[model samples]
Target: MKRITVAVLLLMSFTTRYGGQQTPSRPTVLEHVTVINAGSAPMSDMTILITGSRIVAVDRADATTIPTGAQIIDGRGKFVIPGLMDMHHHLLNGSFPPRPGGIQANLGRLLAVGVTTVFDPSIGRQDFARLKAAAAPDSSAYARFFGTGPMFTVKGDTFADADSPMPETPAQAEAAVNDLKALGVDAIKIQRDDLSWAIKGSGTLMPLEVLAAVVKQAHTQGLKVYAHAPLLKLAKEALSVGVDGLMHGIVDEPVDAEFLGLMKKNGAVYVPTLALFEDVADVAAFARRQAVNWDRAKLQPPAIYAPFADAAGARQIESFLNNSAFTKERLKVARANVKRVFDAGVPVVLGTDTGFFGVFLGVATQIELELLVEAGLTPAEALRAATINAARMIGKERDLGTIEAGKFADLVILDADPLADIRNVVRIYKVIKGGVQYEPVDPATPR
Candidate 1:
């Protein structure tokens, strides 16, 4: 068999030696991998025994002897953790500017990074349902599609990337929510004041009534609502209006004590997409200091990123990054906000806002975990946010997110103990979901 590097694999048309015409199913047993079962009841180690998509048992002492006729993996010093999930992702084909092979390249890169499950808080109506479902279910590689179709933006004033199919009237808004519910979307992404887009350009915000209506109608069908209200006031408003969660910390001012209190009282989960601020600041500084800009030249194709490199998008990026208020110093305040909410024990789910900056999904998920620890989480706590904690937020804690008897067999093989060092969580060797195998590419270390 020809030795393929198995890294930076974006083109899907290529045939692989291991992956071929047939779809791979889940392996029966995984040996040698140190399993860090992220659980609350009783955390222990054992060999995971699987049948179909569910784990049959986890015998602590003897994993090899527990199951026969099972495909056993040679863990060979790898670590095993629950497959990582991302809460805030942009899963759209045309969300960015017109760039050839842009979305395709981004998706491929995401899989390489090890994100097994992703929740695109915002996606276009035309693309979300069709492409999300149209994508094949592989046992491994990339975050599986779990998304809300499009932002419920007001007519005309929507971002160029968004699919603004929102209705203006209360009746129209209610029906729009019903249509999304009928399509069985995971959630609705409520944008800020996009109704005034034509008049105000970018400062446009969604009306309070529209958001309230969407929230009410979507929840009636057992769906959740996520809103993008950057400042404390918007966040508080969303909470007061009974929004399920807040997306990022783009608030115009510092979050006050009263609002923090309300966030705790409401049992609302916060999915702070913090990595963007960090990446932007870090990359900007690097651009100034670096002798050569590699990611722009080699890592990304000019044809792909050209459209997104517009005056408007560039202005937005610069404004967000240039705001000293949202700097590393500000991270202290954000941490205080996180600590305040966390101390109150409000659910702060893990999300990377991947698909930004041409990053692949899988790798971006791990990066999010790394940042979570940097803020305040211990290794185990960080793992929890990505796995068990995320499941709870999605209202799927009863079934998904862990490796146990009767739980789904979605697991990642790591090279070290994430519990001991959360940063080591990226040492992934494979991703197994629902009894299917996504064997990690481990080409022999070059001499």
Candidate 2:
């Protein structure tokens, strides 16, 4: 992960603090909606009552009473589910020195697509305060932002950006964890892979001792450690070191019994960014057939794709295309591994490495659900991965996930039932964040 410049932070702070939308003052009620609570079976003819920023009640519509003067939204034919959470969303643009309006644009696009919360795994430590301010519940314009500070990596690793801390020794690694903890980071992200799949030659991996120290210190600080381990060997090493989650599934090969045992023993969560790998492989395949001309206007949402229409985007695409065979194989292995791991009782949460080339913020999340279904997960199980499972990954299930009373009233009202067909998740009718109903916008249209 790279550091967001001070300039970007200033811009974000200004926009988030002073230029945000207001939430509704009146209590809102959704009556007769089919509710997919994510944790339990879908409930039909449910009534969800929202006051201020919390859900006050959720009961059978026939058994509930409508408060006087409440804003009654007739959800008679709609399906309501917990707002989507993109666990691996990058708040910063994929490119360096992120494009102007990139942060605000990504946030809006995510909210417009029913993503009420986003977790950035590789944010700069200096940007957390501003991110928190931007994600305040009062400002219902964007998805709530949470992130791990800079990702820990070793020195001289090509994948480590200029801003990532290269803690070479155990002490340095411990210090890095302490620094992030002081900054109030949500979690710790460490890189363990050698990047052999993307780069040739002997790629450097983080020292085992240093990786161990980072994980131990992070756990001691009451933070979970998520490792950027894509290969099986690195995944095993990360799990052995007591990391709480694998940011990506094992991509090099099918998962074995030993790996499953380690995952079960550690009670670690598997965040299979299936959409990330599929996007790369799909882009490469497209490039093979024609010239890689990413026309922004041709995209469904031009603003979202505009940032990637430049030379930076081209380079990212070309680099992956150069290793198309490996990339394709990675996607196949990752998909298979997700099913195997999920079947083995290892928790699987939804995460999309959005902001990468071709992985649009909110759009990729929908794609991830579809991909999860393709990987053998039932539509209902796939929804749980993005809803309850994602909240569990961040230890916020008590407050954020499910449709129970007393939780934040973050919901997505869909025109169709996602449990019947996962693609129906994109049939977003309205998005309610913190009891505020935000009209979903067309990304192609200017703000």
Model 1 lDDT per residue over 1-447, tens place: 221111111111112322222243334666545667565533344566666556666655342353334466666567677767678877432224323334433443343334556777776676566545543444322345677877776655435354554666667778988888777688887876321211223465567776788788878878888877656766777778777787775423456677767777766687766665454444333222221222312324333333334556545445534543334445555555654566657777887665555332344456667667777877777778788878877777766677777776767777776777776665556656555555443211100
Q: Candidate 2, residues 413-437: lDDT per residue as tens digits?
A: 9999998899888677777776656
Instruction: Supply the TM-score for candidate 2.
Output: 0.87
Model 1 Cα shift for residue 269 (angstroms): 1.0
How many clashing residue pairs, candidate 2?
0
Q: List the lowest-lDDT window of 10 residues for candidate 2.
A: 5-14
Best-fitting candidate, measured by TM-score?
2
TM agreement with the true structure for every prediction: 0.78, 0.87
Error of 2 at 307 (Å): 10
Tell me the deviation in Å of residue 4 in model 1.
38
| Candidate no. 1 TM-score | 0.78
